[model samples]
Target: VRVLRPLIDEAGYIEAIEDPNAIVITDTLANVDRIVAIATTFDGEAEMDAEVIRFTYAEAGTVATAISEVLGAAGTGARLSVDASSNVLLVRGTQRDISQIRSLARAMDTSPRVAQSETVSTSIYRLQFGEASIVADLVRNTLTGSTDLTNPVAASVGEDPANPDTKIFAVGPEAAPISPVSVQASIETNSVIVRGTQRQLSEVSQLIKALDVRRPQVMIEAAIVEVSGDIAERLGVQLGIGENSQTGGIAATSFGNGGGALQNILVALGQSNAAALSTGLSVGLASDNFGALIQALNTSTSANLLSTPSVTTMDNQSATIVVGQNVPFRTGRVTTDGGNVTEVIKREDVGITMVVKPRITAGGVVQLEIEQEVSSLTNQAVTGAADLVTNRRVINTTVLAENGGTVVLGGLITDDRLQSNQKVPLLGDVPVVGHLFKSRSDSRNKRTLFVFLRPTIMLTRADLEKAAETRYRRAQSAETAVQPRSILKQEKVRKLPLEIDGLY
Candidate 1:
């Protein structure tokens, strides 16, 4: 029992975390002129009992998907090994091919060495349930009001009697207490966690997918300046994106292939594919614009916030950060009460509450109403309320330049518009469509009914069972089973926008 404590501890996780899943695909097919070639490969056998998985987490979306044309184009063997719960193809099939997946990683005017690997995954979790039949069972239990999600220790189960998921294992050595993903009360008033429900997580995943598809398409309207030799170095991404985000790719290319050459290459971006390009790009602490973006976020977004903005300017690169929140009223652009300048601040209506209603049951209705302290609420007549209006959502800005080049601006956002509900597609290349997802309900205080909103992903009980099975087998087979990293739920200003572009 003592030997298996660690593995057993993970058994408590019932669902996947509601977070953006970023992938950095390596470009192995880019030529000197920066034209990338995308190839495709095939699998070992035909699609038979393919799973109908959601790749994310929650309920009903965890099974493997069926083999179809929509999935065939992404890769070869990956199309066949479709476990919907995990959304990625871990298949063993034909040789490596790179035909249908390349994209614009750099400017077309010069040969950019920037490249990405073929990424084939969406976020999903591998869990071990003590005796729950399937993920669908838990979903039904949560939906039907039979399970008390507030008490993770309670047996909130579904109606189905005989459904099981991927990760299941017979009783084994006693393990450590496993902790599941959860959304607890935070210190921030406007901040609401996208958590608990399967649907919420799925929606957040789909929103990321949408942003992934749109960022590259957005045309960069910055004034294009003419630079002579070795200019790509001058076009430094200023956004404080971390080394793991969009700019990360540029830095890696700068180091991997050669630095100065990338600067000389020309980069042309269109609004249509800006989201897609952002997926592969990694803008990090190296840039300046990122710092500015952080300073712009005024709406009280998180509790662990650095109230006093951090401003640091070193050498040619500079970062200025100023963070404040205009709560109980809609925040507007910063304007000073001065007679020397034109209208700098905008006006706004004031209120102090966020109402959330959950559409969970097939036909049932769930209503949740929450309001801040009355002292926090103020009418339009209140001070500073008239000076707040929404013009732009650019918060947390950073400006960057490297090796003597023109500077640029980059920022991060607190209230994200891209995250929504849809079961993310698995590893199949076919035209991937998201599944139906929703956030979980907060039924802890039986005396009061409130819909606790958070990012959610769906998974079937079968998927959990399978994940348990995977973990159990690995534990038994290898000298030490490699446990998946745990996802923590917290929010802080993004120091490096590039880091947001995650690398697996």
Candidate 2:
């Protein structure tokens, strides 16, 4: 016993800190970090039938002591006995409590630490019972109704911070003088841990699983890529989108890869079964329009987020941002004489906000409610004040496309800027030298903005699970885990706009 005291102390320490079932997995292979146990069940008792517990790696000598300490704290059926020649844990128990021992072993195999570090991975959705909230109420009601189970010490819902839709309800066992050594909470992987006699834990696990059924998960990702003004304008001209008829500026235009040098590219895209480019091509001629294409091929698909059918919703609003400009306002007062007085005031213009709502149908059609407000200073004056004018545009329409297609929204937005240059004053305006000084120039730069959207539908969970498994297999099968650094000079690549005849 004195020789095993250190292992017992270590086991007690681990039980106090992390969940008892958490088997530590590390990159150091020589270190012994494996847990093995044989469980036996009898009439009313359970036992760990281990003759020896051997732990290799760093400080391996203390492993048996820790395992003995952990099993001892597990309550009634747990006894610490070991074999000297081969270090293996042996646990034995009565028929009724035998399942608990088996559960402990299984839990260790499925622990998050194990799954993440091991070459093969496996997991089942689990719910963490909440102490408060509707979920908690449900657990309480279920536990109370169950005849074989007693109330748990603690219960709470653990919701995924990134995805609120995924949640787990966790339950804790009643508090004993010393916390049970065998049944420990594994928080990293959100394991559902309940401590009690074999029967009670079994009852609670059933109830939780029955109430909380895992739903198929879908992940959505979006990116915003800003295009340079020069690139946007060139794209617009190549696509044959003329100046905006009403505003006398460039209006957003959509075209396909058809009838241009890019026609071959579109054919290639179709061969790859790219839904965004296949069937019909409604290309919106604007800045950042093709960003979705780049994003889909490189990052989103590679990350396994594109497995399910999903919906892509885009909201874009166009407005002018003005600074150092004064606009008009009015102040009115109701006098005691029952007469109204108004004073004109000039105020600096600030910014504007736009809000839009998107709706999707089962067949993948989308409808959007877009509202845009543009505020600017007016050239004309009224009531002794320069006027502040606001242009509000409201649009409600369905995207002109078939199901599972791409849609472009908010094309009216443009970054329109005006620049002016003037020579120096008086002397600079004189004769020959004045010619240089008196030079005056005005120029305008504009780029149209378009939002691209794609929606995918989630059908089942098997696809996502398979994709993850495949990725893991690929990583493991690779010859070298590290990517080889290139020694050659890399050239920056750009997609050149295609020209049709002499038009562009």
Candidate 3:
């Protein structure tokens, strides 16, 4: 009624009747036609229509309220309603009113608000080959330009007293601007949640790609060899004298009186002289004159291949191989209150063991940190207990070598010598005759140990296959060399006859 009252008054209508859904106007046809024409032309609503405008980004109720206020102030007979559930505006008006409402909605409905100075977005990145916590820390440091997690502000910005240009102001007119970035790790899911701007998130994603890659593997081969040699000689002469005597009595008796008359006795005494000479020589010579002697006692050369262990591990990872047994030794004894003793026994590995950590560099060079040990049980006695003793030779060092190239890590050379002479106190000093009364012995032993190591970087499947083939060939050769002899020939031999030629 309010919207149509002005038009009716200007057209001089006689009377008006209002109804729930319609309105009646009593006036001249001429005045009615004028009023209709003016209403249609001025309001641009020749016929009533309805439109539903669904909001994409803006709230429907808010937009509807604003449009309703504008229509009321402008005195336009347009009704607007909002459907909060569907986020739409329902307008009952002509085409012009609906069009205007759509324009207003478009202008108000935009993307979510973003701050100019501090805008943060959340993103999650899943890791394939890298640790979540470590990657998170790396991302945080890289995005924030700070290495120190405890104090990021102090670490990122610094001041120098001597240089005027190196001063950084935190709260002054010349203060530096810093961007905000935060990163957190979800270890259970193996992912990292980063909160930062689009630019920072992009950088974090790139860094993660570079860091999360498959690690290269290294195959290590070790050889433990022991060489030993021994030589000994002895020369001596001995002489002595001996005396012997024997006495015996024989009695033939028929009775006590007859035995006393027929008694016989026998006695013997003898003197004898003995002499002995001994000489021993051990040398590495092949001559017919001393072939027998040299074969009996000669310089012996022996080589012992203790162990050859091979292991594969990732770069910067530690791998260990033990080719022996663990032996228990008594370390201490404790007496209990009831006079019972308890011995504390510790088991130690007594054999060849090698532990290596290899790191491959960019230029096919391997850096190795190695610990090699060779331990064995010895006959040397322990003073306080019956526990056996052990001799351990260990080498702990680090070196660099080319990939697939063998390098000698370390070596040990040991020399042992012993000499002894024994004789009668004054006879040993008798120049030429001393040899006859003296004995002499000499012994010498030498041993050498060398450790060789080779590292092969396995970066691809082909490399791994090649290394495996090599190891297989080596093991096959070793197995063939130590194969047992055949007993089939011995089984074919016939046994000798038990009663051959009636000799039984």
The most accurate candidate by lDDT is 3
- List the global CA lDDT of all models: 0.26, 0.38, 0.61
Winner on TM-score (1 vs 2): 2
lDDT of 3 by residue, 1-504 (tens): 456566565545443355453446656687678766655565454477998888778899988777777667566667888889989888887677678877888888886665553355788999998899998877766654543212233344556678855634352235323355567899999998877666566767888899888889998766676656421100000001011111112111111111111111000000011111111111111111112212112222344557667799999999999988899999889999999999999998999989899999879888999999888887646687568877788889888766655455434655556778989889888999988988999987765565656677888887786665554544444445554678666554343333333323
Locate the minimum summed-lDDT window of 10 residues in model 3.
Answer: 233-242
TM-score of candidate 1 to 2 decimals: 0.14
Q: Which segments of model 3 are wrong by more than 4 Å?
A: 1-112, 115-122, 140-182, 186-189, 230-301, 382-386, 415-444, 477-484, 488-504
Better of 2 and 3 by TM-score: 3
Query: For model 1, where is the 10-residue window of minimal lDDT?
Result: 214-223
- The per-residue C-alpha lDDT of model 1 at residue 475 equals 32
Q: Put down candidate 2 lDDT per residue, 216-317, tens digits, no spaces.
A: 322221212223355444433533432322323222333333323122222222224343432223332222223335434234221212111122232221
Q: How far is candidate 2 from the true structure (C-alpha RMSD, Å)?
A: 29.3
Per-residue alpha-carbon lDDT of model 1 for 249-284, expressed as tens digits? 344222222222222221211113222222221132
Q: Candidate 3's C-alpha lDDT?
A: 0.61
